[model samples]
Target: MQFGPFLKKSLPKYLFIIPAFLFVVIFMLYPIFYNIFISFQDVTIMNLKGDKSFIGVENYRQIFQDERFLLSLKNTVIYTVSCIVFQLSIGFLLALFFNQQFPMRNFFRSILLLAWMTPLVITGTLFKWLYDVDYGVLNYLLIQIGLISEPINWLGQQSTALMAIIVTNIWIGIPFNMILLLSALQALPSDVYEAAKIDGASRIQSFFKITLPLMKPATLVVLVLGIIYTFKVFDIILIMTGGGPVNATQVLPFFGYELAFVNFKFSLSGAVATIILVILTVISLIYLYLIRKEESM
Candidate 1:
């Protein structure tokens, strides 16, 4: 335990972690700080590789004043909230169902996970076809069921475009929620439920009184992670709508991409990214707090 021997023994362990730590510093931390730095600067495609001129909070002010940014923020909030609600609800139900004894339960659960396992871009493209006004399965099925008189432009019309994306997102998100919640469900002590039953508690009452309270940590984790992931959704919306139908489905990340690449407003793009970074940081802090709380409990 002397200093020299301790240093010799610990050197290898410390060296093992150095590479990954350096990678994070070089790739993740550096880029994040650099982005924050440029967000306040008047950077552009023309001046990007040249010199960046700091302009204080001008970029922030400009983006705040931009109607499209406001609209994108609104869309992002709506999309995140809707996806969370449906995904958590449906996923929780699926978790509960699969947790019960049933034939082919594991098989069906694995099959359902195909949607989550599929690439988001691919899922978006597939749904684009499914949402087609004509020659689409959705409309065909609806017509077969006599729900509508004719095919409706699900992704073409502004009124329905956001809803279409939300539906696809929920489909892709459900499996993740289900898998996590199911694990939490399986981890619950059977003795608790047995005791509740002995006390004459109904299934519904037991679930509300015992299952829910125990699952709070998992639920919070799912919610926080869901919000962060859904907020940063870009490829799916980009491939499906390109933030189109008059920008009805434009979210903050896509809007930032537009500002940086499509519009070549690097400063504005950085500002939007900084905002997203702030939001994500807050969420991460909440996640860390929950983890600590759970551990303490």
Candidate 2:
């Protein structure tokens, strides 16, 4: 009788978890397994439904030899690093400014977040026009201000194409960093600053010595999140440049999309996707390690 009661009580609890567990298995685990499986197979639209014969590491070898893939990798690194640096620096400064008591602080903060709130497609399209050679407001302003003698084609040239997208991404990412860092700044004890002032420390010394060290954890969070977000940027680049101007803005995600959909090289696309997965995984693991170490201390 006791055993029967225990079983009845536990069964409902287990049943409650079944839907969530099954959802994860079907949506998350299944797709990951399928991708890994096809990465080792020679799968294409021609034989997508007929055959998925294993080809060992042929896909990997081919991608390594591919010049476009190498270019995409290089572009990905440059885009990610540039976005992170600018986003962090600009966002931190904004956070510091808004954290202070001032007139219209909340109003200005909301205005600052408008860029982040705008949809990526809209932002991309808006920027594409802004960088237009003839009718762009940006070019008109620059010429009027005597910054340039002529309208410079921002997205139409290989030299400026990548930089254009990087600037857009940096703008989109700054609000996220600002909000996170602002919260950290608010949580810092005011007494620490008061104590520093008593010790004859200037504002600059207090910022470097106390504020920076205390904000390290929040900074790490912002950096890791920025890396992951910028590493997989797609829609903005797609709508803005379409990885164009001689593929100057081709990053890994766009490259993978082109390989799979445009070129119909499913196996090669899978390899590129796998490389991206590995990079994100490594960064995630490092983030977890740092979080654990921080907590232990």
Candidate 3:
């Protein structure tokens, strides 16, 4: 290989990528390395005792053995799955609803995007208030309708605490999915719908045979992106329930926080974070493979 000629040909492209490469190296790669280093050593905010000792796999082993860590893992998995199901389902229904010519369609579309546009912290606080046992809109409405005698402790109860957070996440997530799916629905060929109508295909039948299949790409995109978002969720759980009502809403990110800050176990926290990174990478690859498979067909 002619090194000089290769450099001459590829230098500009490399130059173009230099800024992004530097960014990744400085922000992403550096922090990843730092975390990995922290994972090997026993670290603390104060005395960095046991700094020199190399505790190989001890952190990983400890996290696995800990009941809290195990519960956090299970909760993370359940949270991801439940968030995906609810967001995708509600989003698809909303997409279908808006696909038809409706009054104030543009207004409704803007409102949906507005919800997604609001800051995460703001959303979390609002939801926290809404889930409050003593004074919440949900309980008030339910009471007015004679559905419940007393206000339900939405975030205070172990049974409903996790579910309350999931509901908020779904609300935060649905708008994005709806917008993407709505665009996809609009792009679908009207001729197909017309032909189906002529063939006496019912609305439900046309939706199943034509609409759903065409919306697969949009659905896939939403599902993968939503899963990623929900999996990494921290602020909502922290603000709403503090991963509480006895750790019912404790997902992986919150668990990482609790381990590192609350327990002051940097090594174990880093190990758990690294494990989460591996899982996320695997999930991303699977999603990419499925998307490609669907695209190829």
TM-score of each: 0.96, 0.95, 0.90
On a 0 to 100 scale, what is the lDDT of residue 41 in model 3? 72
lDDT of 1 by residue, 1-297 (tens): 599999999999999999999999999999989888999899988997898887999999999999999999999999999999999999999999999998999999999999999988789989999999979999999999999989999999999999999999999999999999999999999999999999999999999999999998889989998898899999998899999899999999999999999899988999999999998998899789878988898
Question: RMSD for each model, in Å, please?
Answer: 1.5, 1.7, 2.5
| C-alpha lDDT values of all predictions | 0.94, 0.93, 0.87
lDDT of 3 by residue, 1-297 (tens): 999999999999999999999999999999998888878777776656544567778888888898988899899888889888988888888988998897899998899988899998899999888877888898999999999999999988888888888888888888998888889999999999999999999999998999889888878878878877888889888777888988888888999998889988777789988988888888889989988899789
Cα-based lDDT at residue 33, candidate 2 = 80
lDDT of 2 at 250: 96
Candidate 2: misplaced stretches above 4 Å?
Answer: 1-16
What does the lDDT read for residue 221 in candidate 3? 78
Question: TM-score-based ranking, best first?
Answer: 1, 2, 3
User: Which candidate achieves the best lDDT against the true structure?
Assistant: 1
Candidate 1: list runs displaced more than 4 Å. 1-3, 290-297
Question: How well does candidate 3 match the true structure in TM-score terms?
Answer: 0.90
* Candidate 2 per-residue C-alpha lDDT over 114-139 given as tens digits, one digit per residue, 9 for 90 to 100: 99999999999999899999899999
Tell me how candidate 2 scores on lDDT: 0.93
Residue pairs clashing in model 1 are: none
